[model samples]
Target: MEDAKLTPRKLATRIGVAPKTVERWLADAELLPHARNRVDACRALKVDEDMIWPKAVQERVKTGHDRELAHAYPYRSACPSTVWGELIAGASTDIFFAGYTNYFVWLEQAAFIETLRRKIVSGCRVRFLLGDPDGEVTRQREAIEDVALSVGTRIRISLEHLGRLGPLDGLETRFSSPEDAVNHVSLSVFRFDHDALVTPHLARLVGHDSPLLHLRRQGDSGMFDRFAEHAEELWDRGVPQTP
Candidate 1:
């Protein structure tokens, strides 16, 4: 059977609604990627000036794709109340963090990071791969250094810089495919001691759990390997984003 293809307006007509309504869903919701193309086609199919959705509609769809990845990943949660539990309470997470002037920003999880620090104090093999340009990461590293200095041999840090890379995560993370979309997120990725992913987004930017998408299992194994290699390669490069 041929694939179903319909203009957003035609789809709206078939579904007995206004074209703008269709555009609304496309712009303001967690729509599938194909919906991206669909929205463009639909906008072009505008019956008249009144029928055309705002250009912002389609652009917002593109701009918000990063925020929409969470909807693609399946989220699992439990009442165990562990640091990981709260982070994964939804299906998937896409963290949008804005780094400071020139430092990486850890996804918004003060509680979880604090928990990880306790784990580190207990001799956990803690490794952090911070993006060099991120001011947040730089400040956070200073904070860690202060703690380490105070501890004075109680905790040992094994630091390896990954220079300046888009999106950051701790080591031991199984790197995945790059998001082939625009990203408004400042904080890219965060993991809890290499167990689960952590991402930070400004609350209320999107509705509750709106950007938290269920991720599809990747079909390309090579993509995963390439991603892993790229991350490791960057770590080896170790060119800081600053002078």
Candidate 2:
């Protein structure tokens, strides 16, 4: 039943929960999770309250949900039939692979870095394949190495040139050959479990749109598989070199 437009104090008493608790729940990052969960629970309990909620309260929730969706990354899987309904619950995870470095800086994404560190420290397999091996690239690599180490985590990289990439501090770097060759710009995909975020801005800004990395959409697993195969082949074919 919809709430009978009770005042905040009355609603709090009716629910046996504090007003602040209700307000906090409504303000949560993933707000609707509890609404949904509560709906189910109330149905099972056969309890119904006033069916009308105040228009203002409803408007607040609608606005909050819209803001979150516009700002957050999206992922949906048809095969799995699941959605990360962003309510007042919590944020979810995302995995990213980029051919250009600009996107990393573009998002001002300290969140991504921390998530990566958490995944590695928790024993999740993670790797970053940087594009091209040049002198300036080597220095940039060192900076990333320091960042990861400072957090007591490690990032494994498969450098295409140098012999068995180098071991910096405790991080492992190896030179790998082309696992496959391609004539187009591939994609930069960020995955969270069965979901992913794919964008072209990174490669576009850096001018790496060489058909081999044309990241666009994430709804196609077949396309993603093909990209992965090509990258692996190229890495396999590349010869090791030192910077």
Candidate 3:
């Protein structure tokens, strides 16, 4: 108030409120400024409304129901199988999968593999970046899980399935290294065009037990862009499997 050259009486008079009300507002942090009060304060103080009332920032930023960060759906302690089918089947443009051992599950479903093949035939670019089973990062994760060779065995099985798809056009598969920070990743990302399903790894828990986030890009930024960039970085650094 001092910086704004505002005394209680001056601010109250400028906003057409009681000086007592201004005193109350100053005494209590929860006494938020009304919209009109904010406007009056901004003009009188020669400062932005946000500077006068910072709590209302989120209110101003949350433009639409689908446009905010809180719009992401959190699936806690559960990984639904149907989610994969729905996301993959509905994808029209592209599909990118980066996981520890996705093949052990995806390869078992003939329908899923066939659907991917169909998508490839339709000119959709499909990329997979799996963790290197023998990599140091994988070993560390195994220790965290307290399971010996659990991550490595899964990776090897996933690689076998990937090997079968090597001859197919529009399909790319590679293994990502954990040591390479630029390409090193800790989260599992399944991006299908504008929508992405993300699973952030929690300590001492495997991916399946971790919480999942269903994110839809409202515009060209936010969580979608961050995860997409990470996936792309990993993809660029991925080592291709030899035929």
Candidate 4:
């Protein structure tokens, strides 16, 4: 206040607050002014808001279990296509699509095969962990969904697209183990390096209809790591696609 040549009354007048309120804010470090008052005071003092109320700024920022969550979509289809394009383009090290069918990328991402080829040629480790089309779990899910485009058909479509890639080095495709089929079918985790898009399939709902969580890695044991670990575990037990 002295540096700004601002008295309690003067600062109060500038921020449109009572002089006693300004005095209270000055008297107690724990007391914080209203957000607007804080911003006005900072401008009047030619300082940053945090320079005056560090605690308030800290309290306003997300720094908990949900800190890693970048976005949430009530339905997977609601998330913008640009987000997927950005994640895929930004990833340089790893791109693991651990969806049960893994068919949507072919439709959603234009020139997806070309993208994968380029990513592989550039040293990215691309992996697809999919469900077995002929497996009993696939049959069961198809019956549950009762859709014209069956679950098994969807898995086959992904396999067909993957087959076209023609066994490039650093690109691997596998079917989740029979025992893990149920769990794999219930959740889809598509990871692009440190960022992940996760979906937990709701009963009787398709993958696109499920809710999605977009997570960015913040720490070793954050939400991103948890989902990444789950995908890795399934991949470890997966059956390699037959040549």
Separate clash counts for every candidate: 25, 47, 0, 0
Estimate the TM-score of every prediction. 0.27, 0.34, 0.66, 0.76
Model 3 Cα RMSD, 1 decimal: 12.2
Q: Which ranges in model 4 have alpha carbons more than 4 Å from their true place?
A: 1-60
Residue-level lDDT of model 4, residues 1-243, one tens digit each, is 999999999999998989999989988999977888899999999999888899988976788898898889999999999899999999999999999998888999999999999999999999999999999999999999999999999989888888898589999999999999999999999999999999999999999999999998989988999899999999999999842
Candidate 3's C-alpha runs over 4 A off are: 1-79, 104-110, 181-185
What's the TM for model 2?
0.34
What is the C-alpha local distance difference test score of each model?
0.33, 0.35, 0.74, 0.93
Residue 34 in model 4: lDDT: 83
* Segments in model 2 whose C-alpha atoms lie over 4 Å from true places: 1-96, 102-107, 111-115, 133-186, 201-243
Over the stretch 129-205, how does candidate 1's per-residue lDDT look in tens digits?
Answer: 33332234333444544542321121111111212221233212221112311121222333322123323334322
Q: Write the per-residue lDDT of candidate 3 for residues 1-243, one digit (tens) a residue.
A: 798788999989998999999899889876787888878878888898776578887675766644634333344335455666677878888998887666435644556667878899998998888887778877777777886548878878767766766668888888885555223435888888888888776777776666778777776667788888988877787788652
What does candidate 4 score in Cα RMSD to the true structure?
6.9
Please report the candidate that would top TM-score against the real structure.
4
- Which candidate's lDDT is highest? 4
lDDT of 2 at 163: 21
Any runs in candidate 1 off by more than 4 Å, and if so which?
A: 1-107, 134-225, 239-243
